[model samples]
Target chain A: MDANWIAIAASVLLQSSPLIIAVCGETLSERAGVVNLSLDGSLLLSALAGFVAAYFSSSLLLGFLAAAGVGALMALIVAFGSLALRQSQVAVGFVLTLLGDSLSAFLGQNFTRLPGPWVQRLPIPLLKDIPVLGPIFFNQDLVVYFSLVLVAVTTWWIFHTRPGLELRSAGERPEAAFARGVAVRRLRYWYAVLGGALVGIAGAAYSLDVKIGWAEGHTRGLGWIALAIVIFGGWSPLRGALGVLLFVATRSVISVVLQRSLGESSVVILNALPWLLMLGVLVVVGGRFSEQVLSRLPAALQRPFRGLLRAAPPAALGAELKEG
Target chain B: MSRPAWLPRLWPLLPSFVALLLTSLLLLAFGASPPLAFGAIWEGAFGNQDRLLTTVAFWIPLMLSSLGLLISFRAGLWNIGIEGQFILGAIGASWVALSLQLPAPLQISLQMLAAMAAGALWAGLAGVLKRWGVHEIFGGLALNNLAIILTNYLIAGPWQPPEGGSFRGTAPFHADALLPLVGATRFSVVALGLALLAFGLVVLALRNSAWGLRLKALGRNPRSALLLGVSSRRETLLAMAFCGALAGLGGAVRVLSWFDSLRQSISGGIGYLALMVVILAAFRLLWTPLVAFFFAAVLSGSVVLQLRTQLHSSLGNILTGVLVLLVLLFGNLDSLRAWWAEWRAGRRRS
Candidate 1:
């Protein structure tokens, strides 16, 4: 076990970065009383678009931008359906999932088995020289650095800002916020799109780091795992870091252990451990009274801002605006 | 203020057909005439004696599995794991017929029963999980994966055929265990017969039974059904099991009728296609045949285009995605329907 201890830990951290990015983005959305169920589809489409953009243009920044653009476009579908037409966000999101899958498969069909750009790693001078921590932390790629900062910045935004206060008020009691003149719908749209952009980067992070080559059906269920981590962390940024760490760690362990314990074909069977574990965690969370506690949670959760029915995070997240 | 529901029904079908034709036109875009490509697609699928036989063979399992999809949708459930269930069913049927070494006639009956039971139990696990507070989508997703893995484990481990790793599947069932097909149609005569019978039974059950009423009520409005004490949990669990059994039957027929053995990709995304079929059929259990046959033709057609033209066959996926999007968006749009109907009435007045 000690033979690969340092390497395993390094890979685990790397693997967890995408989850961290996705969850942090979702954390923002959930905090504002909107749940973007299309995180899975958004991550997928963006990941493909990112890979495609970089493959043709050979620009990593453009790849990242493309990912974010795709994410916002996917989120737009959720925003319009849940916000404008007032359809159930969950339903629309599910439809988006199916569409995302077919569209990706169709688009990626030609691109499958094609070569993609390799993301360059940047190491800081002084920090890269720091003992064991140097190679493990400071010598990581750019997204790795942004993911950590995003968490801190999100934490600060929620606790310290004036607009954040109104957003919180909107999430907690939209009617109250509405009476106080907080534009709940507009705020939610922004949060959803922003969150979507973050999730997009999270997807592109895959092609940039772990599996640098492009492929179809890549980033399978990572978005779903991020959603589970959001709930597992109780929708807090700091704790969500742990949940993502735990998920990625489990997946890393499963691959290593199953390869040793089971043959190749059987190993295919166990490839789904990470996703199954996420679903299990979600089921456990749902059975707990946390959903009720969900309403009583942070003042800004399931309810959109600037309307009635102020509540906590996602008792029924991604619900359509009823306009009552 | 509600317009007649049937008024806008034909619109969705028309778009789907247009999309299907345009996909074929893509073949012409590559230099094959639309009619020649269409003719080749039809002939390759059902034109001659042998191709028609194999086409029927292909249709048996797909149609059966799709019917299973309709059953679940009727209860407002999306049993997306039908592909997994279909695979497991084949595995179960193979395991029984081969491992048990039963008499000829008794072997297949037992195998079919085992397949159905495996599917029901697998789906039942998800049902029980949902009953305990898990969402159906998550539960179905998990179970789909779990079933795939578990079946892979079975096939790759103890059930690994005596032939070894060159082929990763079970040993062929006994000769008598195989079902006979119609002249050139690849479908097992008995399996297709049973499916037809099951079709009638499903229609009757949905239309006449007290249980059917309960399911319909729950699907339409679970909250109101709960108020009426319809026991949503129980009905949902039962509906999932029923759907699973239907899918399992399809799996059983695949081995006995078409492929004659199980493989890793036994169901081959048919479960997903079944989801599309259910939506396209508007969750009509009886409409399963019509939709599955139509899509099956499109699928086989794409394969023809591939052999004729070097372009990607996945163009079909893009088209299907477009059709689904239009149907979903337009189906729920009250404003769109009203505008179309108003325009139609205006034309009539003139």
Candidate 2:
């Protein structure tokens, strides 16, 4: 029984690694006041690029680099289009998402469902000997460890670092940040690119590590889920990581527990669970009801509750930035 | 001053020309001939009578959904859940067609009405969720999945054929329940008439109606619109429902004419394609149908493009996507002029 539980826990962590990376990447972008709404498209295109590159060059590093490049290029388009051309970010992102999807579909015709390279598991030296926690967290591949470190680093960078403070200010009050000589446009441009590069890596992680192999829409709707979870996590990196874990855990439980007892028919209905969870999380954390409820609590409890439930977005997010 | 009379007129078509150039470059990168692909699409879409009719068949649902989107977009709503609403419409029409014992005309009319109501109700659910502080994008997305699951359940569970359940779909509906198609084609004059009627109504409503003015105000600034005494909640629900109803009608047309029974992927991403159509049209009423027809033609032609060139059918989608992006980037004359001026200034500085 214990072994089964540990296995399930480890699988959940492994499954959620890509999402964790993607969510952190998105959190970084949203923190810098840019919303990369083209995540779904970016992810699909990058997954294809990653798989294709890895297949041809036979190197995982090249696959990840190519995917990140594609991701950064897409982010640059969104940033430039919205900031320079004065187009709506959502419009640009949405168009890019569709463009990316079709582009992948057209370009990836020959690469569909073909077996390709993947990340090999590399357990830590002494940590694998430990009991439950070791097998669950430490006995995973490089991508999994990277995701863990990414969450901690992202949380620290966004909350503790001086540059992080500037990023927050860029997202929360670009005009004020600019007044303080923060170079908001340049900061936004670079951070958006950085975030997009991380997103690209996450896409590669899926094809070269998590899900494995390339197909059209290999990561469809995941970008939207990541986008929704960014809001659900209140744009916090740590919280977003937890959200992905919780989502992946519940999905595994449903597929494993329910699918066994209910048979094949239940699988179709079960597919709706993740989306339903997304809606449920957004409604619970996103609404004014949570704040109202928090306010009604005792003084001692209110602070913790407020911190836990806070879900407001960055003030300057998606706003057009004009350079004079 | 010495330029030809048509030269100024040609400026408006600049985005299309640019998009064509970009698509040509993409084709070249793929080691495919642009002329051959374009020729394939053109021949596939309009080379023969049958192909023209097929393109028109695809156009009916696309036009309906695009028209519906114009309403919601005017009200500043994304209505991404239109996909779910479209599926609900198919479900509603399927319900009527399967269970009803009415006359042919009555059955068809009832099916359409049911489809509209189902679509409106589904869209209204998203609107209500929006009212509850859930953005329609998330709500609609979730609802779309739920709608798909619901369709799958219906087809595999309760509505399964006499032989047994399968993922293919439910059994075909009775002849009386189906739409009267034009000779040897899925194209129905009735569906065409409905779409054209919707187009006329949308144009008139957006142009002359007080409601259209209210939607414009709301879309521009919701808070200010409320301050100006516009009831945003009422307008939002009404606009979403109105859009859903049309999309549902489009769904009804799909199941009733395009196919014989309720099936998987009934809308086939038409809801999303319609969104692209509206955006490409620049949200203008006059251009909506024309752009939709263009999209429909490309998509219809893709089948032939694939068959002849051994290329994937998504080339049409890529072409449209590129066009829309270019339009978003450089379609506006002001943006183009600004970019041109900036380039010249940068060169002089260097």
Candidate of highest lDDT? 2
Per-residue alpha-carbon lDDT of model 1 for B167-286, expressed as tens digits? Answer: 566666677677766764555778878888888888887888988888899988899999999998789888888888888888888877776666676776677677777776667766
Clashing residue pairs in candidate 2 (N, C-alpha, C atoms within 3 angstroms) = none
- What would the DockQ be for model 2? 0.72
DockQ scores for all the models shown? 0.34, 0.72
Interface root-mean-square deviation (Å) of every model: 3.1, 1.6
Tens-digit lDDT track of model 1 for A270-324? 6767657866676656543334545665677544421221212544355444322
For candidate 2, give the lDDT of residue B179: 88
Judged by DockQ cut-offs, is candidate 2 incorrect, acceptable, medium or high? medium
Residue A319 in candidate 1, Cα distance off native in Å = 2.8
Per-residue lDDT over B23-139 for candidate 2, one digit per residue giving the tens place of the 0 to 100 score: 889889888899998998999999999889989999999999999999999999998898899999999999999999789999999999999999999999999888877889889
- Alpha-carbon lDDT of model 1: 0.73
- Give the poorly placed runs of model 1, Cα more than 4 Å off: A1-4, A26-41, A82-92, A158-185, A254-272, A288-313, B1-7, B13-43, B49-53, B332-350
Query: For residues A41-153, could you state the per-residue lDDT of candidate 2 as single tens digits?
Result: 99999999999999999999999999999999999999888776778888889889989998988889999889999999999988987889889988999999999999999
- Using TM-score as the measure, the top candidate is 2
TM-score of each: 0.85, 0.96
